[model samples]
Target chain A: MIPATLNVYVGLSALLFAVGLLGVLLRRNTLVIYMCLELMLVASTLAFVAFSRFNGSMDGNVFVFFILTVAAAEVAAGLAIIVALFRKRLTVQVDQLDGLKH
Target chain B: MFPAIFTFLVLFTAVCAAGVIVCRNTVNAAMCLLLCLVGVAGLFVCLEAYLLAFLLLLVYAGAVVTLFLFIVMLIDVRGGAPRARNPLATVAGIIAAALVVGGLASFWVRGHLAAPAASATPALGASLKAYAYPLFTAYLLPVQVLGFLLLVAMIGVVVLSRKPDPGPKP
Candidate 1:
Protein backbone atom coordinates (compact mmCIF):
# COMPACT_ATOMS: atom_id res chain seq x y z
CA MET A 1 0.00 0.00 0.00
CA ILE A 2 1.30 3.42 -0.86
CA PRO A 3 1.71 5.69 2.14
CA ALA A 4 0.02 9.05 2.04
CA THR A 5 2.58 11.77 2.54
CA LEU A 6 2.14 14.81 4.76
CA ASN A 7 2.39 17.08 1.75
CA VAL A 8 -0.82 15.70 0.27
CA TYR A 9 -2.84 16.64 3.32
CA VAL A 10 -1.21 20.04 3.60
CA GLY A 11 -1.82 20.73 -0.05
CA LEU A 12 -5.46 19.77 0.33
CA SER A 13 -5.80 22.13 3.28
CA ALA A 14 -4.31 24.96 1.27
CA LEU A 15 -6.68 24.38 -1.62
CA LEU A 16 -9.70 24.26 0.66
CA PHE A 17 -8.65 27.48 2.35
CA ALA A 18 -8.21 29.23 -0.95
CA VAL A 19 -11.62 28.13 -2.17
CA GLY A 20 -13.23 29.38 1.00
CA LEU A 21 -11.41 32.69 0.68
CA LEU A 22 -12.65 33.06 -2.84
CA GLY A 23 -16.23 32.39 -1.78
CA VAL A 24 -16.01 34.95 0.99
CA LEU A 25 -14.69 37.53 -1.43
CA LEU A 26 -17.17 36.86 -4.20
CA ARG A 27 -20.46 35.91 -2.59
CA ARG A 28 -22.95 38.66 -1.90
CA ASN A 29 -25.52 36.80 0.16
CA THR A 30 -24.87 36.89 3.87
CA LEU A 31 -25.80 33.24 4.31
CA VAL A 32 -23.42 32.18 1.52
CA ILE A 33 -20.64 34.23 3.05
CA TYR A 34 -21.36 32.57 6.40
CA MET A 35 -21.13 29.14 4.79
CA CYS A 36 -17.78 30.11 3.29
CA LEU A 37 -16.59 31.14 6.73
CA GLU A 38 -17.45 27.69 8.05
CA LEU A 39 -15.59 26.19 5.10
CA MET A 40 -12.50 28.13 6.10
CA LEU A 41 -12.82 26.91 9.65
CA VAL A 42 -13.00 23.31 8.46
CA ALA A 43 -9.95 23.86 6.29
CA SER A 44 -7.93 25.02 9.27
CA THR A 45 -9.15 22.11 11.34
CA LEU A 46 -7.91 19.75 8.60
CA ALA A 47 -4.45 21.29 8.79
CA PHE A 48 -4.38 21.02 12.56
CA VAL A 49 -5.32 17.36 12.42
CA ALA A 50 -2.70 16.64 9.78
CA PHE A 51 0.01 18.26 11.87
CA SER A 52 -1.09 16.44 15.00
CA ARG A 53 -1.05 13.10 13.25
CA PHE A 54 2.40 13.52 11.74
CA ASN A 55 4.04 15.04 14.82
CA GLY A 56 2.46 12.48 17.17
CA SER A 57 1.38 15.18 19.59
CA MET A 58 -2.11 15.72 20.98
CA ASP A 59 -1.61 19.49 21.21
CA GLY A 60 -2.92 20.10 17.73
CA ASN A 61 -6.01 18.01 18.40
CA VAL A 62 -6.61 19.93 21.58
CA PHE A 63 -6.35 23.17 19.66
CA VAL A 64 -8.76 21.82 17.08
CA PHE A 65 -11.29 21.22 19.84
CA PHE A 66 -10.96 24.78 21.01
CA ILE A 67 -11.30 26.03 17.46
CA LEU A 68 -14.49 24.00 17.05
CA THR A 69 -15.93 25.46 20.21
CA VAL A 70 -15.09 29.02 19.21
CA ALA A 71 -16.44 28.47 15.71
CA ALA A 72 -19.78 27.26 17.09
CA ALA A 73 -20.07 30.35 19.25
CA GLU A 74 -19.15 32.59 16.37
CA VAL A 75 -21.78 31.01 14.15
CA ALA A 76 -24.46 31.46 16.77
CA ALA A 77 -23.68 35.13 17.13
CA GLY A 78 -23.27 35.63 13.40
CA LEU A 79 -26.57 33.97 12.49
CA ALA A 80 -28.34 36.03 15.11
CA ILE A 81 -26.86 39.12 13.58
CA ILE A 82 -27.94 37.95 10.15
CA VAL A 83 -31.49 37.34 11.32
CA ALA A 84 -31.70 40.73 13.00
CA LEU A 85 -30.36 42.40 9.92
CA PHE A 86 -32.87 40.56 7.79
CA ARG A 87 -35.73 41.50 10.07
CA LYS A 88 -34.96 45.19 9.77
CA ARG A 89 -33.94 45.37 6.12
CA LEU A 90 -35.71 42.34 4.60
CA THR A 91 -32.64 41.63 2.51
CA VAL A 92 -29.67 39.34 3.15
CA GLN A 93 -27.42 40.84 0.51
CA VAL A 94 -24.21 42.39 1.83
CA ASP A 95 -24.20 45.25 -0.64
CA GLN A 96 -27.68 46.25 0.54
CA LEU A 97 -26.37 46.32 4.12
CA ASP A 98 -24.41 49.54 3.89
CA GLY A 99 -26.48 51.52 6.35
CA LEU A 100 -23.45 52.07 8.53
CA LYS A 101 -21.50 53.61 5.66
CA HIS A 102 -23.17 56.93 6.37
CA MET B 1 -4.87 1.53 -0.72
CA PHE B 2 -4.78 4.11 2.05
CA PRO B 3 -3.10 6.67 -0.14
CA ALA B 4 -5.70 6.15 -2.83
CA ILE B 5 -8.50 6.69 -0.32
CA PHE B 6 -6.76 9.77 1.01
CA THR B 7 -6.34 11.23 -2.43
CA PHE B 8 -9.99 10.59 -3.26
CA LEU B 9 -11.14 12.24 -0.03
CA VAL B 10 -9.01 15.28 -0.72
CA LEU B 11 -10.39 15.66 -4.21
CA PHE B 12 -13.95 15.18 -2.98
CA THR B 13 -13.48 17.90 -0.39
CA ALA B 14 -12.01 20.30 -2.91
CA VAL B 15 -14.83 19.76 -5.35
CA CYS B 16 -17.52 20.21 -2.72
CA ALA B 17 -15.84 23.36 -1.49
CA ALA B 18 -15.81 24.75 -4.98
CA GLY B 19 -19.47 23.86 -5.33
CA VAL B 20 -20.23 25.89 -2.23
CA ILE B 21 -18.77 28.89 -3.99
CA VAL B 22 -20.01 28.31 -7.50
CA CYS B 23 -23.59 27.21 -6.90
CA ARG B 24 -26.10 30.02 -7.13
CA ASN B 25 -28.85 28.49 -5.06
CA THR B 26 -28.35 29.16 -1.37
CA VAL B 27 -29.72 25.77 -0.32
CA ASN B 28 -27.52 23.96 -2.81
CA ALA B 29 -24.50 25.83 -1.55
CA ALA B 30 -25.34 24.87 2.02
CA MET B 31 -25.67 21.21 1.04
CA CYS B 32 -22.33 21.41 -0.71
CA LEU B 33 -20.85 22.76 2.49
CA LEU B 34 -22.28 19.72 4.30
CA LEU B 35 -20.56 17.41 1.83
CA CYS B 36 -17.30 19.29 2.29
CA LEU B 37 -17.52 18.92 6.05
CA VAL B 38 -18.14 15.20 5.74
CA GLY B 39 -15.19 14.86 3.40
CA VAL B 40 -13.00 16.59 5.97
CA ALA B 41 -14.24 14.18 8.60
CA GLY B 42 -13.17 11.33 6.37
CA LEU B 43 -9.76 12.92 6.10
CA PHE B 44 -9.60 13.03 9.89
CA VAL B 45 -10.41 9.34 10.10
CA CYS B 46 -7.70 8.61 7.56
CA LEU B 47 -5.27 10.43 9.85
CA GLU B 48 -6.39 8.13 12.73
CA ALA B 49 -7.97 10.84 14.84
CA TYR B 50 -11.20 8.91 15.35
CA LEU B 51 -12.66 11.07 18.08
CA LEU B 52 -12.00 14.28 16.21
CA ALA B 53 -13.44 12.79 13.09
CA PHE B 54 -16.72 11.88 14.75
CA LEU B 55 -16.88 15.23 16.50
CA LEU B 56 -16.41 16.98 13.19
CA LEU B 57 -19.11 14.92 11.52
CA LEU B 58 -21.52 15.45 14.41
CA VAL B 59 -20.89 19.13 15.03
CA TYR B 60 -20.14 20.55 11.61
CA ALA B 61 -22.03 18.29 9.25
CA GLY B 62 -24.90 17.54 11.61
CA ALA B 63 -25.48 20.71 13.63
CA VAL B 64 -23.82 23.56 11.79
CA VAL B 65 -25.10 22.65 8.36
CA THR B 66 -28.60 22.13 9.72
CA LEU B 67 -28.47 25.54 11.34
CA PHE B 68 -27.42 27.03 8.05
CA LEU B 69 -30.30 25.37 6.25
CA PHE B 70 -32.77 26.51 8.89
CA ILE B 71 -31.61 30.09 8.57
CA VAL B 72 -31.66 29.90 4.82
CA MET B 73 -35.26 28.69 4.89
CA LEU B 74 -36.22 31.23 7.52
CA ILE B 75 -34.85 34.03 5.39
CA ASP B 76 -36.84 32.75 2.40
CA VAL B 77 -34.16 33.57 -0.14
CA ARG B 78 -35.52 32.79 -3.61
CA GLY B 79 -33.46 31.64 -6.56
CA GLY B 80 -32.65 34.74 -8.56
CA ALA B 81 -30.15 36.06 -11.02
CA PRO B 82 -26.60 35.89 -9.81
CA ARG B 83 -25.27 38.99 -8.17
CA ALA B 84 -23.07 41.31 -10.21
CA ARG B 85 -19.46 40.11 -10.24
CA ASN B 86 -16.86 42.30 -8.60
CA PRO B 87 -13.87 41.93 -10.93
CA LEU B 88 -11.55 43.92 -8.74
CA ALA B 89 -12.35 41.85 -5.64
CA THR B 90 -11.95 38.59 -7.59
CA VAL B 91 -8.55 39.62 -8.94
CA ALA B 92 -7.35 40.70 -5.51
CA GLY B 93 -8.61 37.54 -3.83
CA ILE B 94 -6.98 35.27 -6.42
CA ILE B 95 -3.68 37.09 -5.97
CA ALA B 96 -3.85 36.85 -2.19
CA ALA B 97 -4.76 33.16 -2.13
CA ALA B 98 -2.09 32.33 -4.71
CA LEU B 99 0.56 34.10 -2.67
CA VAL B 100 -0.39 32.22 0.49
CA VAL B 101 -0.40 28.80 -1.23
CA GLY B 102 2.87 29.51 -3.05
CA GLY B 103 4.62 30.61 0.14
CA LEU B 104 3.58 27.50 2.06
CA ALA B 105 4.50 25.21 -0.84
CA SER B 106 7.95 26.76 -1.11
CA PHE B 107 8.49 26.45 2.64
CA TRP B 108 7.52 22.80 2.53
CA VAL B 109 9.78 22.13 -0.45
CA ARG B 110 12.79 23.78 1.25
CA GLY B 111 13.28 20.81 3.64
CA HIS B 112 12.03 22.74 6.67
CA LEU B 113 9.17 20.35 7.38
CA ALA B 114 9.51 19.02 10.93
CA ALA B 115 10.43 15.37 10.77
CA PRO B 116 8.40 13.36 13.22
CA ALA B 117 10.35 12.00 16.15
CA ALA B 118 10.49 8.25 16.63
CA SER B 119 8.90 8.45 20.06
CA ALA B 120 5.29 8.65 18.88
CA THR B 121 3.11 6.77 21.36
CA PRO B 122 0.92 4.05 19.87
CA ALA B 123 -2.18 5.25 21.74
CA LEU B 124 -1.81 8.91 20.83
CA GLY B 125 -4.20 8.83 17.91
CA ALA B 126 -7.47 7.28 19.08
CA SER B 127 -7.08 7.05 22.83
CA LEU B 128 -9.00 9.40 25.07
CA LYS B 129 -6.66 8.68 27.97
CA ALA B 130 -3.84 10.25 26.04
CA TYR B 131 -5.84 13.44 25.46
CA ALA B 132 -7.70 13.67 28.79
CA TYR B 133 -4.60 14.07 30.92
CA PRO B 134 -3.29 17.19 29.24
CA LEU B 135 -6.76 18.58 28.57
CA PHE B 136 -7.73 18.46 32.23
CA THR B 137 -4.37 19.41 33.67
CA ALA B 138 -2.18 21.51 31.42
CA TYR B 139 -4.99 23.13 29.42
CA LEU B 140 -7.64 23.31 32.15
CA LEU B 141 -7.84 27.06 32.23
CA PRO B 142 -8.45 27.45 28.52
CA VAL B 143 -11.18 24.84 28.65
CA GLN B 144 -12.92 26.73 31.40
CA VAL B 145 -12.59 29.93 29.38
CA LEU B 146 -14.10 28.19 26.41
CA GLY B 147 -17.18 27.25 28.43
CA PHE B 148 -17.52 30.85 29.54
CA LEU B 149 -17.23 32.07 25.96
CA LEU B 150 -20.00 29.72 24.88
CA LEU B 151 -22.27 31.02 27.64
CA VAL B 152 -21.66 34.59 26.58
CA ALA B 153 -22.33 33.72 22.97
CA MET B 154 -25.63 32.09 23.89
CA ILE B 155 -26.78 35.21 25.74
CA GLY B 156 -25.64 37.44 22.92
CA VAL B 157 -27.64 35.44 20.42
CA VAL B 158 -30.79 35.81 22.43
CA VAL B 159 -30.26 39.52 22.92
CA LEU B 160 -29.47 40.15 19.31
CA SER B 161 -32.46 38.24 17.96
CA ARG B 162 -35.08 39.75 20.24
CA LYS B 163 -37.94 41.59 18.62
CA PRO B 164 -38.28 45.30 19.18
CA ASP B 165 -41.20 46.53 21.24
CA PRO B 166 -43.97 48.34 19.40
CA GLY B 167 -44.16 52.06 20.10
CA PRO B 168 -47.08 54.49 19.78
CA LYS B 169 -47.49 55.65 16.24
CA PRO B 170 -47.15 59.37 15.68
Candidate 2:
Protein backbone atom coordinates (compact mmCIF):
# COMPACT_ATOMS: atom_id res chain seq x y z
CA MET A 1 0.00 0.00 0.00
CA ILE A 2 1.65 3.18 -1.12
CA PRO A 3 1.24 6.31 0.97
CA ALA A 4 -0.22 9.25 -0.84
CA THR A 5 2.21 11.98 -1.81
CA LEU A 6 2.36 15.24 0.15
CA ASN A 7 1.24 17.11 -2.96
CA VAL A 8 -2.09 15.30 -3.05
CA TYR A 9 -2.83 16.29 0.52
CA VAL A 10 -1.83 19.89 -0.08
CA GLY A 11 -3.89 20.02 -3.26
CA LEU A 12 -6.92 18.71 -1.43
CA SER A 13 -6.34 21.36 1.21
CA ALA A 14 -6.18 24.05 -1.44
CA LEU A 15 -9.36 22.87 -3.06
CA LEU A 16 -11.22 22.95 0.21
CA PHE A 17 -9.87 26.42 0.93
CA ALA A 18 -11.06 27.64 -2.42
CA VAL A 19 -14.50 26.17 -1.86
CA GLY A 20 -14.68 27.92 1.48
CA LEU A 21 -13.56 31.19 -0.08
CA LEU A 22 -16.19 30.81 -2.74
CA GLY A 23 -18.86 30.22 -0.12
CA VAL A 24 -17.78 33.32 1.72
CA LEU A 25 -17.98 35.33 -1.46
CA LEU A 26 -21.26 34.01 -2.82
CA ARG A 27 -23.36 33.49 0.28
CA ARG A 28 -25.13 36.41 1.90
CA ASN A 29 -26.33 34.61 4.99
CA THR A 30 -24.02 35.59 7.80
CA LEU A 31 -24.07 32.18 9.50
CA VAL A 32 -23.22 30.23 6.35
CA ILE A 33 -20.48 32.69 5.54
CA TYR A 34 -19.06 32.17 9.01
CA MET A 35 -19.18 28.40 8.47
CA CYS A 36 -17.21 28.87 5.27
CA LEU A 37 -14.62 30.87 7.18
CA GLU A 38 -14.25 28.00 9.62
CA LEU A 39 -13.92 25.67 6.64
CA MET A 40 -11.00 27.74 5.41
CA LEU A 41 -9.38 27.55 8.84
CA VAL A 42 -9.73 23.78 8.95
CA ALA A 43 -8.27 23.50 5.45
CA SER A 44 -5.19 25.46 6.55
CA THR A 45 -4.77 23.27 9.60
CA LEU A 46 -4.85 20.22 7.34
CA ALA A 47 -1.99 21.71 5.33
CA PHE A 48 -0.07 22.42 8.52
CA VAL A 49 -0.46 18.87 9.71
CA ALA A 50 0.46 17.49 6.31
CA PHE A 51 3.56 19.64 6.07
CA SER A 52 4.56 18.76 9.60
CA ARG A 53 4.10 15.12 8.81
CA PHE A 54 6.32 15.32 5.75
CA ASN A 55 9.00 17.43 7.48
CA GLY A 56 9.24 15.36 10.68
CA SER A 57 8.38 18.38 12.81
CA MET A 58 6.19 18.77 15.88
CA ASP A 59 5.59 22.49 15.54
CA GLY A 60 2.68 22.23 13.16
CA ASN A 61 0.89 19.73 15.35
CA VAL A 62 1.34 22.02 18.34
CA PHE A 63 0.14 24.94 16.28
CA VAL A 64 -2.99 22.98 15.37
CA PHE A 65 -3.62 22.34 19.05
CA PHE A 66 -3.56 26.07 19.60
CA ILE A 67 -5.79 26.62 16.59
CA LEU A 68 -8.35 24.16 17.96
CA THR A 69 -8.39 25.99 21.25
CA VAL A 70 -8.87 29.36 19.60
CA ALA A 71 -11.55 27.98 17.30
CA ALA A 72 -13.68 26.79 20.19
CA ALA A 73 -13.54 30.24 21.74
CA GLU A 74 -14.14 32.00 18.45
CA VAL A 75 -17.22 29.91 17.73
CA ALA A 76 -18.75 30.78 21.07
CA ALA A 77 -18.16 34.48 20.74
CA GLY A 78 -19.18 34.63 17.09
CA LEU A 79 -22.48 32.81 17.63
CA ALA A 80 -23.23 35.04 20.55
CA ILE A 81 -22.71 38.12 18.44
CA ILE A 82 -24.87 36.70 15.68
CA VAL A 83 -27.66 35.99 18.18
CA ALA A 84 -27.44 39.50 19.60
CA LEU A 85 -27.60 41.03 16.17
CA PHE A 86 -30.60 38.96 15.34
CA ARG A 87 -32.37 40.00 18.53
CA LYS A 88 -31.80 43.66 17.91
CA ARG A 89 -32.52 43.75 14.19
CA LEU A 90 -34.86 40.77 13.74
CA THR A 91 -32.69 39.61 10.88
CA VAL A 92 -29.44 37.81 10.22
CA GLN A 93 -29.31 38.73 6.55
CA VAL A 94 -26.18 40.79 5.83
CA ASP A 95 -27.67 42.91 3.09
CA GLN A 96 -30.46 44.13 5.34
CA LEU A 97 -28.10 44.89 8.17
CA ASP A 98 -26.43 47.67 6.24
CA GLY A 99 -27.80 50.52 8.30
CA LEU A 100 -24.57 52.47 7.91
CA LYS A 101 -25.08 52.83 4.20
CA HIS A 102 -27.29 55.89 4.60
CA MET B 1 -4.88 0.46 -0.47
CA PHE B 2 -3.50 3.58 1.25
CA PRO B 3 -3.93 5.89 -1.72
CA ALA B 4 -7.40 4.52 -2.31
CA ILE B 5 -8.42 5.35 1.25
CA PHE B 6 -6.82 8.77 1.01
CA THR B 7 -8.56 9.53 -2.25
CA PHE B 8 -11.91 8.43 -0.86
CA LEU B 9 -11.54 10.57 2.23
CA VAL B 10 -10.56 13.58 0.19
CA LEU B 11 -13.57 13.18 -2.05
CA PHE B 12 -15.86 12.73 0.95
CA THR B 13 -14.56 15.87 2.63
CA ALA B 14 -14.75 17.99 -0.50
CA VAL B 15 -18.25 16.88 -1.31
CA CYS B 16 -19.47 17.49 2.20
CA ALA B 17 -17.88 20.95 2.25
CA ALA B 18 -19.57 21.80 -1.00
CA GLY B 19 -22.76 20.42 0.49
CA VAL B 20 -22.39 23.03 3.20
CA ILE B 21 -22.40 25.74 0.59
CA VAL B 22 -25.12 24.37 -1.64
CA CYS B 23 -27.56 23.24 1.00
CA ARG B 24 -30.14 25.98 1.32
CA ASN B 25 -31.25 25.19 4.85
CA THR B 26 -29.01 26.19 7.75
CA VAL B 27 -29.52 22.87 9.54
CA ASN B 28 -28.41 20.93 6.48
CA ALA B 29 -25.37 23.15 6.14
CA ALA B 30 -24.44 22.52 9.74
CA MET B 31 -24.84 18.80 9.23
CA CYS B 32 -22.69 18.98 6.13
CA LEU B 33 -20.04 20.76 8.15
CA LEU B 34 -20.15 17.95 10.68
CA LEU B 35 -19.68 15.33 8.00
CA CYS B 36 -16.92 17.34 6.36
CA LEU B 37 -15.13 17.50 9.73
CA VAL B 38 -15.45 13.77 10.17
CA GLY B 39 -13.89 13.21 6.77
CA VAL B 40 -11.09 15.58 7.75
CA ALA B 41 -10.50 13.51 10.86
CA GLY B 42 -10.16 10.48 8.63
CA LEU B 43 -7.57 12.36 6.60
CA PHE B 44 -5.80 13.28 9.81
CA VAL B 45 -5.57 9.63 10.68
CA CYS B 46 -4.07 9.01 7.27
CA LEU B 47 -1.46 11.65 8.07
CA GLU B 48 -0.68 9.68 11.25
CA ALA B 49 -1.72 12.57 13.46
CA TYR B 50 -3.87 10.40 15.69
CA LEU B 51 -4.22 13.01 18.40
CA LEU B 52 -5.35 15.74 16.02
CA ALA B 53 -7.73 13.35 14.30
CA PHE B 54 -9.65 12.83 17.51
CA LEU B 55 -9.21 16.43 18.58
CA LEU B 56 -10.73 17.69 15.36
CA LEU B 57 -13.62 15.30 15.78
CA LEU B 58 -14.12 16.13 19.44
CA VAL B 59 -13.79 19.89 19.25
CA TYR B 60 -15.13 20.56 15.79
CA ALA B 61 -17.81 17.95 15.33
CA GLY B 62 -18.80 17.53 18.97
CA ALA B 63 -18.72 21.17 20.05
CA VAL B 64 -18.50 23.59 17.15
CA VAL B 65 -20.98 22.01 14.78
CA THR B 66 -23.45 21.45 17.62
CA LEU B 67 -23.21 25.11 18.50
CA PHE B 68 -23.87 26.03 14.90
CA LEU B 69 -26.96 23.80 14.84
CA PHE B 70 -28.26 25.23 18.11
CA ILE B 71 -27.90 28.76 16.85
CA VAL B 72 -29.54 27.86 13.58
CA MET B 73 -32.54 26.48 15.40
CA LEU B 74 -32.73 29.36 17.88
CA ILE B 75 -32.64 32.01 15.21
CA ASP B 76 -35.10 29.98 13.09
CA VAL B 77 -33.92 31.23 9.73
CA ARG B 78 -35.50 28.93 7.15
CA GLY B 79 -33.37 29.64 4.10
CA GLY B 80 -32.02 32.42 2.01
CA ALA B 81 -34.34 34.76 0.22
CA PRO B 82 -34.34 33.66 -3.41
CA ARG B 83 -33.14 36.90 -4.92
CA ALA B 84 -33.72 38.21 -8.40
CA ARG B 85 -31.70 36.84 -11.32
CA ASN B 86 -28.79 39.17 -10.73
CA PRO B 87 -25.88 37.24 -12.16
CA LEU B 88 -23.23 39.87 -11.61
CA ALA B 89 -22.18 39.13 -8.01
CA THR B 90 -22.50 35.41 -8.52
CA VAL B 91 -20.48 35.51 -11.71
CA ALA B 92 -17.83 37.69 -10.15
CA GLY B 93 -17.52 35.41 -7.14
CA ILE B 94 -17.18 32.32 -9.33
CA ILE B 95 -14.45 34.05 -11.31
CA ALA B 96 -12.58 34.95 -8.15
CA ALA B 97 -12.82 31.46 -6.73
CA ALA B 98 -11.68 29.94 -10.01
CA LEU B 99 -8.73 32.30 -10.17
CA VAL B 100 -7.64 31.41 -6.66
CA VAL B 101 -7.95 27.70 -7.31
CA GLY B 102 -6.13 28.02 -10.63
CA GLY B 103 -3.29 29.95 -9.01
CA LEU B 104 -2.90 27.34 -6.29
CA ALA B 105 -2.97 24.53 -8.85
CA SER B 106 -0.28 26.21 -10.92
CA PHE B 107 1.84 26.72 -7.84
CA TRP B 108 1.44 23.10 -6.90
CA VAL B 109 2.53 22.01 -10.37
CA ARG B 110 5.49 24.41 -10.46
CA GLY B 111 6.53 24.47 -6.80
CA HIS B 112 9.52 22.31 -5.94
CA LEU B 113 9.21 21.62 -2.24
CA ALA B 114 11.87 19.17 -1.13
CA ALA B 115 9.81 17.10 1.28
CA PRO B 116 11.48 14.31 3.18
CA ALA B 117 10.12 10.83 2.65
CA ALA B 118 7.32 9.82 5.01
CA SER B 119 9.24 6.73 6.14
CA ALA B 120 12.06 8.96 7.36
CA THR B 121 9.73 11.48 9.06
CA PRO B 122 8.98 11.12 12.74
CA ALA B 123 5.35 10.55 13.61
CA LEU B 124 5.26 13.01 16.46
CA GLY B 125 1.52 13.50 16.21
CA ALA B 126 0.81 9.82 16.78
CA SER B 127 1.23 9.96 20.53
CA LEU B 128 0.05 11.97 23.53
CA LYS B 129 3.43 12.42 25.21
CA ALA B 130 4.93 14.03 22.16
CA TYR B 131 2.10 16.56 22.24
CA ALA B 132 2.39 17.18 25.99
CA TYR B 133 6.11 17.89 25.85
CA PRO B 134 5.75 20.82 23.48
CA LEU B 135 2.59 22.15 25.13
CA PHE B 136 4.59 22.38 28.37
CA THR B 137 7.94 23.50 26.95
CA ALA B 138 8.96 25.55 23.91
CA TYR B 139 5.34 26.38 23.02
CA LEU B 140 4.36 26.99 26.64
CA LEU B 141 3.90 30.71 26.10
CA PRO B 142 1.36 30.26 23.33
CA VAL B 143 -0.59 27.78 25.43
CA GLN B 144 -0.82 30.32 28.25
CA VAL B 145 -1.87 33.04 25.85
CA LEU B 146 -4.56 30.81 24.33
CA GLY B 147 -5.99 30.15 27.77
CA PHE B 148 -6.26 33.89 28.32
CA LEU B 149 -7.87 34.31 24.93
CA LEU B 150 -10.48 31.71 25.81
CA LEU B 151 -11.28 33.55 29.03
CA VAL B 152 -11.62 36.84 27.20
CA ALA B 153 -13.86 35.25 24.58
CA MET B 154 -16.10 33.79 27.27
CA ILE B 155 -16.46 37.14 29.00
CA GLY B 156 -17.09 38.94 25.73
CA VAL B 157 -19.76 36.50 24.69
CA VAL B 158 -21.50 36.88 27.99
CA VAL B 159 -21.52 40.63 27.64
CA LEU B 160 -22.57 40.58 24.03
CA SER B 161 -25.48 38.24 24.64
CA ARG B 162 -26.66 39.97 27.77
CA LYS B 163 -30.26 41.11 27.89
CA PRO B 164 -30.36 44.84 27.28
CA ASP B 165 -31.65 46.91 30.21
CA PRO B 166 -35.16 48.04 29.56
CA GLY B 167 -35.60 51.37 31.30
CA PRO B 168 -38.24 51.29 34.10
CA LYS B 169 -39.91 47.97 33.38
CA PRO B 170 -43.26 47.93 35.17
DockQ top scorer: 2
Clashing pairs in 2: none
User: Which prediction has the highest TM-score against the true structure?
Assistant: 2
lDDT string for model 1 (A1-102, tens) is 334666667777877887888788878888999999898888899888888888878898989999999998998899999899888888888776789897
Error of 1 at A48 (Å): 1.1
Which residues of candidate 1, in runs, are more than 4 Å off?
A1-3, B79-83, B97-123, B167-170
What does the lDDT read for residue A64 in candidate 2?
96
Q: Residue B64, candidate 1: how far off, in angstroms?
A: 0.5
Q: What digit string (tens of lDDT, one per residue) describes model 2 on residues B1-170? A: 77788878988998999998999888899899999999999999998999899999999999999999889989957434655644888788878977987888796879656787788878878989989998899988988899899999999998998999788968
User: By how many angstroms RMSD does model 1 differ from the true structure?
Assistant: 2.8
lDDT of 2 by residue, A1-102 (tens): 335778778887888898899889888789999999899999999999999999888999999998889889989999999999999888887767889997
Q: Give the per-residue lDDT digits (tens) of candidate 1, residues B19-77.
A: 99999899999999999998999988888889999999888888888899999989867
Candidates in order: C-alpha RMSD to true structure:
2.8, 2.1
